[model samples]
Target: MSLFNMPLLIQDTAAIEGDMGMLWMLISGILVFFMQAGFFLVESGMTDSKNAVNIAMKNFLDIAVGSLAFWFVGYSLMYGADMGGGFFHWGGFIFSQGAADLFFQTVFAATAATIVSGAIAGRTKYTTYAIFSIVMTAIIYPVAGGWEWNGGWLNNTDGIMPAEFIDFAGSSIVHSVGGWAALVAAWMVGPRIGKYLNGKPIEMHGHNQMYATLGVFILWLGWFGFNGGSQLAWGGDDATAASQVVLVTNLAASAGAIAALLFTWIKNGKPNLGMTLNGALAGLVSITAGCGNMSEGGAVLAGLVGGILVVLSIGFIEKTLKIDDAVGAISVHGVAGAWGTLVIGLWGVDGDAGIGIFNGGGAAQLGAQAIGVLSYAAWAIVTSFIFLFILKKICGLRVTEAEEIAGLDISEHGTIAYPGKRQREME
Candidate 1:
């Protein structure tokens, strides 16, 4: 039928519908873009005072380098026509599949690339970090993303989870991927000087709590987009799903923050700001995988569980494993990502609940989630080790002891972030 002959109600409604959907997607994308700043402050605040500026630079540079790399190759490797028999594929170069999808994927690509910066914060050379950023965006992250988000093996119909596996956003694909890489990088780089003493733990303090808190708030704000944008529609079915996703995401984060705060208060006899802050993040990470499909109540349960788990896991890693993760990135991202992915098989409530204990399903989905988590962890650890080892051989991943002790702010960048003269190295 001709447009002039079409019914007025149908035509008017369709126009409004299209406009609203576009608006929603655009706004969500913008919010996700802002998260880069949030991550910046959080990482910067977690480091020693001597290296704040250097940390900030690494965060910024990762985005810059990551964006370029993703634009050139990563997007295609991830979302282009799948190859490598659905295992892994190398797609063509820059601007593949046009500009729109590349821009959207670039933000996510950079986030994954940025995660390692926190773990290696105190000792990495700027040049080394920059190079690794490119590798992460162009190779490591894209290949992993292909397996899940882009219809590779993890998300394939013949795959492990198949009918039951789900990740609405990227709890496992993004956060866990980043965390796994961070874990390996930290171990390879070794602990910061004086972080440990003959197997004893030493306290390390942040330079600016104020900046870190601000960063947390920013991250919280950005999460709406992070989860919502995954719907990929501005309105109608997509928008409806996006709204539900945002609601669940917020609930989980809130519950996580509360649970973490209470846990710390009882254990330490006082409210711990850092732990509280991380709790909120823990909730967000835990919900990322299932935000689109979970009920409000399910989100709360996931958030609380994730927050508490993050606290315990961080302690275990630091005390038992003795991994020197400066900002608790590994625990908050890796552990929580795994939990969130599994939680979906339990509490997911939308049409695509997959399979869940709550929905009369047993351990099938859970087993699949576990496989996905372990596979990502193993792959990330092995590849990260190989990548860093090569970097060490060729250009040295770590700075000299003198440079580390002096602090990267001045030693690496030739400027003290703080105004006052600095104290001597802790030794």
Candidate 2:
């Protein structure tokens, strides 16, 4: 039918999609921004109450310090003109016209920085963490992210990649970067005092399971925007793709939570609330890479596996590796992020055909996924290790043993999260 005869609701989205996209980005940015509160709650509630205020301060630092760094320098490095054949860039520092996109991406950089906070909670020096937060948001994160997101060598067009590396909502870019850095920070800071004694692990339960549970619920609610808004548009085919992203995201999270709940119930003779919460987050991370290309069944499968894997991974990191990750950030984000990225090569879809090996695609896509996964791991590990090593040697990465024993809230922040629960000595 002619446009003049068409109904008002039938206008092509292309006529209005630009504005729609900006609106969506702003909405999504707000949602992603709220995740900061979620992180604060989860990290605080999952760790000792004595350290709650310290955790609160670190989370506060991540968004506050992290955002300014991303704005002034990181964005230019990531989105400015490529300077060294995708390895370097310059210009656009503290400047940009695309405000909506800029705000959205800024939140992601903050999210990456905050992951380290939970892992290093309690014993790490707050000033050192504040510095690391700046380093991550500015240099370490942006440089690696530029490689793919900014059309750098790792992207398919570089002629080095065997296939396109897909990470629709940043399972690898955002989550894994934070996860691996957390791994290094946890290792370098050296397990929390008395976390282990003579080669045996000790259980350090989080002070407030109720708060942790609430935190997970908030994060789950935010994922809808995190995944859906990644489509970067709001009409035409963008509409359908965004809808699918939301659907798959939810399904994966549900499956992840269920898998963890069931597994712990069977193995531990009861459901573990902590593990279950992490499982849901793992599922969310797992589906993030493939959400745009996955079917409902694929999303569920990925999340279920991610959920089970997180439980196993947490145990191995804590007991076997002896890395004292207070909130299990490494497993739920890093390990699950790698799995999420790699699963695309196993059963991910392209148009109507599967891009994964089991779906009739060759090993090429899998190879690419593996390469991307390894590249991120190595980059995050090496850079974070060096930075943290320096911070440890020069400025001190951890609190004094006495300060740790006293609890970071009192020792570092000069306050407590729950003052009523503490004795005068604790204060």
| Best candidate, TM-score | 2
lDDT by candidate, in order shown: 0.79, 0.87
Q: Residues 1-427, candidate 2: write the lDDT tens digits.
A: 2211111111111322578888988898899999999999999999998998888888888888888999999989887888987777766669554888788888889989998999988899998999999999998888878877777777754577899777778899899999999999999888998899899899999999999999999999888888887777887767777787898899999999999999999999999999999999999999998887777888899999999999999999999999999999999999999999999898887756667887777898898899899998999999999999898888999899999998998999888877778766556
For residue 169, what is the lDDT in candidate 2? 80
* Regions of model 2 farther than 4 Å from truth: 1-17, 424-427
TM-score of each: 0.91, 0.94
**Model 1 per-residue lDDT tens digits across residues 1-427:** 2211111110011221355555665676678778889988998887888898898788788778888888888887787776776667666776465344466678888888788888888998888888888888998888888887766777555655545357767898889989999999988888889989889768788878888899999999999888877776655455566677788789999999999999999999998888888999999999998786666777888999998998998888888888888988998898899899988677455453335666655666667677788888887888888988999999998899999988898888998777654534332
The global Cα lDDT (0 to 1) of model 1 is 0.79
Give the number of the best model, judged by lDDT: 2
lDDT of 1 at 170: 83
